[model samples]
Structures are given as C-alpha cells and as structure tokens.
Target: MDALKILIIPGSARDGSFNRRLAEFAARQARAAGQEATLLDLRALNLPLYDADLEALSGVPAGALRLQQAIQASDAVLLVTPEYNGFPTPLVINAFDWLSRIPATQEQPAGLAVTANKPAGLLSASPGAGGALRSMNFLRQYLQMAFAMVVVPQQFALGRAHEAFDATGALQDPRAVQSVETVLQSLARLAQALKTA
Candidate 1:
C-alpha cells in the first residue's frame, strides 16, 4: 500500500498547549511509519470568527480556502482536540464553520467535497482525567454526521497531558505511546481501504 497523506490539526492555539504537543508527536510518528504527515497550525491560519455577514460580504476567508485545499489533498485527518469546558475550542469550530460555507464550484462536486468520505482519526489531551475526551466525542459526531467523514473507531485520550510528554516532546509513558500508535495504524488502514473501495 502507498503511504497515507495525513493532516494533523490541533484544536488549541496556545503557546504551550498539550494538544499541540500531541499533534506534533503524532506527526513525527506518522512520518517514522512511512506516512506523510503535516501539522497544521491554526494560529498561523488566523481564521476569523464565523459570521454569515462576513461571508455574504467577503466570501470564505483565504484561510478557509487553504484549509479546504489541505483536506482535499490529504488521504486522512487526525484531529487533536483540547476540551474547553467539555467542548472543542472555539477556534477550531470557527475554522470548520468557515469551511462548510464555501460553495461548490465546477471543480468540486459538492459543498462539502473536501471533507465528505474522508477518513478521520480523533485524539485528545488534557491535564485532567477526562483528557478532553468530551471534546473528542463531540468532534467525532459532528465530523461524521455533519460532514459525512468516516472516522476510525480507534481513538486515544491522553490524560494528565501536562506530564505526558518529556522535554523532547516525545510521549513519556510506554502505554500512551502504544495507544497513539494504535490509533494511527487504524486510521491508515481505514484510509487505504476506503481509497481502494
């Protein structure tokens, strides 16, 4: 099978976000396993709040266009989300809101062409025991039901993420490493299978 192209998106944009560290670690692991992985920095995208008035006046922002193109190019996506009071961060939600508003063109078959049927892997990290799992659950449901994305059943939640990674940004616990690896492997397998199907 060919190497899967994976896009890793971290929900948090904070300077020292545990989810960001997890995303970076996942990218490295994917590359080491002979897959192509790109870590998407939402802060760099600088996406504006999702406002229908802005869309009516200016159309989807360049950041949303770029995000659509990125998703269209990838075989699968890995969403590393942080829980903000049991919900995914507003930034990531806003980004997706913009993406969903982009109209279909001659080159694109549907408005959700970039996301529909795409394989997705869900992961989350938090200092608390929940490990942002609530946010992950919400994302999984939203992506699958709203966008028709096919999410892999295998998922991971890194609890106590503040201490999960080492100084080098690598996962400290062997079990945590194994959990991440399992999720990635399942995601790759699903992507490959779906592509062939």
Candidate 2:
C-alpha cells in the first residue's frame, strides 16, 4: 500500500506555540511509522474570519481555497490545538468554519474528498496539567460533523506540553512520546482500514 498521507493542522498561531510543536512531533511519528505526514500551519495561511461581507465582495479567498484543496487531498486529518482559557484558539475555529463549507459538487469532486467522510484524529496539548484534553472533545465532535471518522482509541492529552518537546521537536519525556505514539499507531491502522474498507 502507498504510504497513508496524514495532514497535521495546527490550531495555534504563535511561532513558539507548544501546540504547533506537538503537531511537529506527530508528523515525525507518522514518518517514523512508514507513513507520510505534513504540517499545515494556519499562521502561514493568515485567513480572515469567514464572513458574508468578505465573501460577497471578494469571493472565497485563494488561500482558503488552497487549504480546502489540501484537506481534500489528504487521506486523514489530525487537528492539534492549544487550549486558550479552556477552549481552542480563534485561528483553529476559523479553519474549521472555513473548511466546513462544502464546495459545489456535481457528484463529489473526482478522486479528492473535500473534507467529507475522511478519517480524523484529535490531539490537544497545553501548559496546564489537563493537557488541553477538554478541547479535544469539542473538536472531535466538530470534525465528525465535517464527515471525518474521528479515531478515538488512543486520544492524546499532554500536560506541560512546553516541556514535552525539545527545541528540535523531539519528545523529551518518554511517557509523553509513548502516549502520543499510541495514537499515531492507531491512526496509521485506521487510515489503512478506511482506505481499503
């Protein structure tokens, strides 16, 4: 089988965001497990909030369209979010709201699926002990609505995520890496099952 492609969407915008670092770690794990992974940073997209006024005047932004395309092509989605005041950041929500709009399809666009019925996984990391776990519940439900089968067997909730990774994105704590690897492994299998079954 061709390597399962996993797209990591980072919810935090900070350049040094722990959430983003956790995403990086996940991408690495996917590769180490003989799968392909890419980190799609929302900060680079700099999407404006989805609004009727902007859409009416400017139409869908090219960047947003490109992002939707990326999501459509990927085999699976992994949302890595940071809990801000016990919720995900605006950028994360913005990504979801923007991608939620299904582009017009005569009978679904060719080989690619525009975020519908794709397998998804949720991960959250925070400086707090709870590890942004609460954020994952909301995000999982949201992704499910987008038609992504959320992988739930090995959910990751890393407390003190800042200390979980190093400057090189290496997971510093053995326990933390094991926790995340469990999810990565499960996702790898599900991606294959969903592709074949």
The 0-to-1 C-alpha lDDT of every candidate, in the order given, reads: 0.91, 0.77
Residue 128, model 2: lDDT of 90
Off by over 4 Å in 1: 108-111
- As for candidate 2, its clashing pairs are none
Residue lDDT tens for model 1, 32-61: 999999988877777888888888898878
- For model 2, how does the per-residue alpha-carbon lDDT over 103-164 read when each residue is reduced to its tens digit? 66684452224666677787888989999988888777766665455555578888987677
**TM-score per candidate:** 0.96, 0.90
Q: What count of clashes does model 2 give?
A: 0
Decoy 2 TM-score against native: 0.90
| lDDT score, candidate 1, position 57 | 93
